[model samples]
Target: MTSNSDTPASGFLPPRWFIRAAWKTHKALYRWSGGRFGLRTPRPDRYGLAYLTTVGRRSGVDRSVMIGYFEDGDGIVTMAMNGWGAPEPAWWLNLQAQPEATLDLAGGTTVPVVGRRAEGEERDRLWERWRELDDGLDGYAARRPTETAVVVLDPRTD
Candidate 1:
């Protein structure tokens, strides 16, 4: 098996310990919040407690991930990866392959959102808006080499 060092530096290759710790913490928090409040609160700050379910590009299995979200007009936008200076997350690639995704909000609302990759002015605007809400995003941007793209999830009414 190829080690993380062999992988591209741009992508997220957190240490094994870090990954385990994060997973454990996430799972614990998810269980606690879910049991107590009937909600999954992976990310409490920035009003982030939603899960994005995406279809795997190759595996064809549905994958779910907890992520941070911000309201952008009528749509909801989420950063596709970690703010710790990693490459675009796998979920973004999955969305690229399949734009249709399901979002489970904290309020027990599950909605189908059409994912669109934002670029140019739209991307810039959203990036700015994200930074304004989360200052850590600024540091995350500084660590990344490539400009991150925004995944705009337009809520489907139908």
Candidate 2:
């Protein structure tokens, strides 16, 4: 099938349902294993996985989800993409509403952070970094109806 700047190639990635299920299973693995599984540190050319907890905008409750990220200086960077779907991820929306959050990394390390969107040159640089990690980054991003936000989670001292 032919693809354009607006339409991403389909066969490159699994269907949306499968992608969602995989993430659900990953979360389950983390929970069932008592946080022993489902997360890894970012290598020089690969992204890391972590569980992020954010406050719900309306419910006022804590919401947590697994996300992929890479360390940048003192902050962590991730994309607000919903499995490459058109809609923005709920976790990202929650972060926008309440930026203060918690990041649960591998080896039982938890870091408090404040989330914000990376803009201008920072966004371009971080987006390019992500492109290096995934060969199909641009293709997957094309599936989104809107531009994806590059989220920066900076460590919160207080």
Candidate 3:
């Protein structure tokens, strides 16, 4: 897709179908190969892909999603924008009700973590980091009618 000086991401995100399929493929490859391939995407955007497991708020079952994330201190940070960009993702909603979760990095290492939204200076700092990773960050975010959320999966302490 062609981009202009005034527009980033070319003013559009990939079709939701492609995004979902790619995600499923990413997860499958990581799981099946055990990190032999499809470990991460380095170009266009950098995402230390991980599987995040969260307890469902209503279903009372575990829900998992393959998410793109970047390192933040001793934790990992990722956005909660649904692929099509509208109502927030189910994982984020579940995290809101129960912050405790586990993250499997590239299907190789599992880390128990507590998820929370970054706020104030911390939020800005994280957002800036995301901008560095993806020039289309704002363009993709603008598609959402509501503010996109940044969720930090801080290491869990037992």
Per-model TM-score, in order, reads: 0.74, 0.93, 0.85
Show where candidate 3 strays beyond 4 Å: 1-9, 34-36, 41-45
lDDT of 3 by residue, 36-146 (tens): 665553343566777889999999899888888998779799999888468899999999999999988753678999999999999999999988887888888877898
Q: Distance from true position, residue 105, model 1, in Å?
A: 0.3
Clashing residue pairs found in predicted model 2: none
Model 1 per-residue lDDT tens digits across residues 1-158: 43233333323355646864775576467556762432443332454556788999999999876666777777888776553545677778898999899987776788899899888999999897776666556544556677677778998877
- Give each model's whole-structure lDDT: 0.70, 0.91, 0.83
Give lDDT tens digits, candidate 2, residues 1-158.
Answer: 35633332332677899999999999999989999999999999889999999999999999989999999999999999989888889999999999999999998999999999999999999999998898778888877889999999999999
lDDT of 2: 0.91
Off by over 4 Å in 1: 1-20, 31-45, 83-85
Angstrom error at residue 104, model 3? 0.6
RMSD, every candidate, angstroms: 6.9, 2.7, 3.4
Query: Between candidates 1 and 3, which one is better according to lDDT?
Result: 3
